[model samples]
Target chain A: MNQNKNALLLLTGISLFMAACGTSKTGLITIQEQGSFAVGGKVIASPGTFDPYKPTPAGQTFHGDHAYVFYQIPPKARKYPLVMWHGIGQFSKTWETTPDGREGYQNIFLRRGFGVYVLDQPRRGNAGRSTAAGTINPTPDEQQWFGTFRVGIWPNYFEGVQFARDTATLNQYFRSMVPNVGPIDIGVTTDAAAALFQKIGPGVLVTHSHSGGMGWLTAIKNQNVKGIVAYEPGSGFLFPEGEVPAPIEMAGGQMAAVGVPMSQFMQLTKIPIIIYYGDFIPEKPSDNPGTDGWRARMVMARLWRDAVNRHGGDVTVVHLPEVGLKGNTHFPFSDLNNLQVADLMSKFLKDKKLD
Target chain B: MNQNKNALLLLTGISLFMAACGTSKTGLITIQEQGSFAVGGKVIASPGTFDPYKPTPAGQTFHGDHAYVFYQIPPKARKYPLVMWHGIGQFSKTWETTPDGREGYQNIFLRRGFGVYVLDQPRRGNAGRSTAAGTINPTPDEQQWFGTFRVGIWPNYFEGVQFARDTATLNQYFRSMVPNVGPIDIGVTTDAAAALFQKIGPGVLVTHSHSGGMGWLTAIKNQNVKGIVAYEPGSGFLFPEGEVPAPIEMAGGQMAAVGVPMSQFMQLTKIPIIIYYGDFIPEKPSDNPGTDGWRARMVMARLWRDAVNRHGGDVTVVHLPEVGLKGNTHFPFSDLNNLQVADLMSKFLKDKKLD
Candidate 1:
């Protein structure tokens, strides 16, 4: 009986090891535990198209798409092209429209010579902001699939994940419809870029926010990526150990969410990363097991440090106190704050001599 | 004779009009020229390859070829990818790493959760830094054919405009590479990130500084880009009208080599952009050329305002005397006096929930 037990134990250990390596496909799962935290409501589902500056054509892939906010700056140059992405909420448009009369980040990049693009993160926004809706929205197979998913703060709300995926596809397709924009598919884009490198080679790529993980993954995957200048990338998810907190921040107060594999991007990608946490210093009450932002920042920093230590490259972690921003909340990309952030980025871009 | 003269005048005017539109690739070039300037440089050629980061492996399509510092920041997840196309004698690495220390705008994103990437910039770097005895190093074009280049800055000789085609090619390649680091190119690894979005989709793109123009061109060439965030991008060489000075404090003693297409990204992409520049309130005579970074920061603040007014974002420009930094060079990301730049980016990223 004892011999049999030992053999079983050994078999289990080996099996676990194999699973860990193989599981990289779905990434590590992040589990959120309900705590004393509560928010406005359960998420609502809505089908809406949001374009800050204008509207998309009905047949356009991005048509009827809900957006947090879509904005456009007067055209600066033909060399410049439209760039857009999704924010956390189903629609990031709310953040774009600040009561403070600040210019949104969209306009900021516009004036400087960038066409702005943003999409409504599917199933997020007012759609998900339901009164009693719990933070984690479950999919049809919540029981079987809920606990096993990772990346975002919430459980694998089938719609939310679908929404994110849709955003990517739509953005890809939408770029094709826009004049002067590049091709749609990722393969085409990268292959074309690679081909271009063959003819005239090398350049830059850009990204932001939750998209940072996606962007990082994309950049590393493509050999042509030259450098990256990410702003406040959501890398906290990379760490699963230590004092884990809620995966996201709720309006009411601090919330506790399960950990997932989305955070694994940092661990997986050794590409140089610079994590930014808007200026929000925690006070005495900071240790309240509720707030997740503080913990997230620390974890991100640790992850970056570890990456740098392991890999000989430059990765920095910055705390922007001047802007007084907290993690992934309403963005300062509105108005003066937008300019401030833009200025710093501008300087960095110039200094780094990216291309 | 009078009628003939009148006819001739009308014909001349018509020809000029056609030239204005026809000569420009994009019909809106005239309007985009409203905010324009020039930063010039020679394009040093370097051998190109599918694997610029490493030696070309067997079967790589893009083997030894012409190249240049193409892009910065992978399309992963960050505000923007900023490219710093080095001036004539400057290579991508030099702009990133100065003799003094690691100084370059690329650091801005690297510290802010950005996936910063920099190329040898084709012909520029990788070409022998030392000129051959009794023979001028081949111009970028000649070098491309010969397939030779070196790394780092080649001292006083900052070449500009010698490799316009190379620049365009670099832009094209990097633009194509966008999908690699973005949601579209989900699971690939320059980093070990899984293609999470492949099951779904991609996000956004951002760029900064001199790379801003490159970003713009990349966007225009490769339309899949979702959003852009350019900071202090160089003005349009094509439209050299309302050019602004590089901040003296930021530029330090040197100004960016004249006439490179940083700001021109606006015109190229016709995309939205966010720009930022410091208002240097100069306090010393040495800072007379306020564009140079020799002035005291207090004084640099005032100068920064002018530069911003002349060249910053169309949405908003933040002139912060309080946030003013000193003893820095034109490279905004290289600010040592105040890491506020990094902090600012962090705040914005966090606000965007990118952190």
Candidate 2:
């Protein structure tokens, strides 16, 4: 009986260990709340008597030009949520699960006890209703995007690209790209972002690619933006009105800095900002439009960085390859090594005392 | 020492119990696979020399008219995955978490060990690029949708409506509506859905509102459709060419049953099918267009049921009010009592042995 009791105890101990291990691995996320809402849309009323029973007459009103925000707050969340805004032709899905089924930044940040707010900018993705009309030409633009996104030329991966190279992953990646329902209006998008900041109140703004430029303007428009973490702001670098940098000529087009008032530009200087760029961007100008475009952007980024630092603002630009984290594509956050990249971000947050 | 050992063993046993309980409550979901892909889009190449280095000239090719599908499969999933397609002005968001933040049918069915495939039909939502050009006029049509959706007239909820009445919920609901980036082409949408079935293999097709008609056509188009569970198929009731019913007139316009060949119509008879209609749909046609429109639809649905039954098909139509489940809006799957609605679906699946 004594031996049997000892064996039972040992079994219980083993069971407890396994149970605890399993719980940690598969523990349910205790969510404080998760919901979605819209911001910055207007109602355009038409000149006719609206009737539900009949076909909508020419005078019916329209409610559009809005941005949509989906948010999830975990229990014991940090002080501020990370507001994730996607780039051109993308939606909140960019921050959700990656095309390869890996955890995206939304889940990654949520696991680290920070609330996450993913946005669909006006006239894009879920916010498809627009006040302005634009033609969505069924144009074969995947290869164009592939080159632009630095995923490498079609049919070939850049030697050390961090993106998943499997056919399934590639299929999903291409499928994720969506077209804008209306014309791309930077002002409307910026207004929506500012409105989101106003509604959510005091949050870190995270922007990718095309939205990077809008992020700067949003910070200037709203004081609620505590900080900004941008990944490859492809365009829309702003400077105080007479200080705009000379345009960097690219194979596609000329990349120029937009000029904002000195006061609005100074609002960006009030916040700590960090920028991240992935691999394959050459130090010098190259004939390959894909790499060269980014090279120009990086050069502009440094100029912007210097300008901010000169004004007593904190700014840091990280080239992943230079930091020993190589082979990252434009989308470093969704790359396979995203967890490592996230750690780098966490360190920055800690150093800046934002966490 | 023996006393201490007994105490330790008891503590271990208690700890094991707690861990097991915690795991059951909050265990992390082990996903077998999750990814997305597009199906059935034609590539329309413009007539010109394509140049990557220059502006997209007139000759650039466009990939449009495709449906985008996001799928998540759980380990040990049921035999057939649930293919969820949304209705007018909506996307896969309809099946995701609801406006009120409740687990939508996607997660609900996923938790029940069923793989879920959420689709964005061609020219709509995520699949916004289209071959045909259409206008998205910014229209204030939320009131029209509210009435048509049976949530009640503007600013008024049907007494005991199943929809969440909070302003936040209302805001989210209105924001969820997306305009078609191009024309609303049912043929194109049906073709894409058929292609999705062909790609994914045998699965149960679940559709809501507008897609309900397309679901029936999809079943006829592809043999991979194992079953169908539709919620409020507002239009596109199919009948044998010779037996097409006269169009039902409504305050809005006329509701018509599309005609298909008898051979194609017979395909629906091969699968087990079920339909659910929510509350506020009156039994008799009334002057109130909102209720009357649905009353006409319900009447048409019964006629459809008779037609299917006449041809030896398995079809069941459940009016929630008649079955003691009351106060449901058009979207019963995302209602406050969605779990109950899910239970009814589960029962049907069991009866049909599709699970």
lDDT of 2 by residue, B277-325 (tens): 9999877666677778888787788889889989999989999999989
DockQ for each numbered candidate: 0.01, 0.33
* DockQ top scorer: 2
lDDT of 1 at A324: 48
Q: Sort candidate 2 into its docking category.
A: acceptable
By summed lDDT, which 10 consecutive residues of candidate 1 chain B come out lowest? B32-41
Instruction: Give the per-residue lDDT digits (tens) of candidate 1, residues B96-144.
Output: 4222333244444443335443332221222111111111111112111
lDDT (C-alpha, whole model) for all candidates: 0.32, 0.82
Q: TM-score of chain A for candidate 1? A: 0.43
**What tens-digit string does per-residue lDDT give for candidate 2 at A58-109?**
4445667789787767655798789999988888778877878787887778
lDDT (Cα, 0-100) at A44 in candidate 2 = 71
The docking category that best describes candidate 1 is incorrect
lDDT of 1 by residue, A145-182 (tens): 11111112222222212122333322221111101011
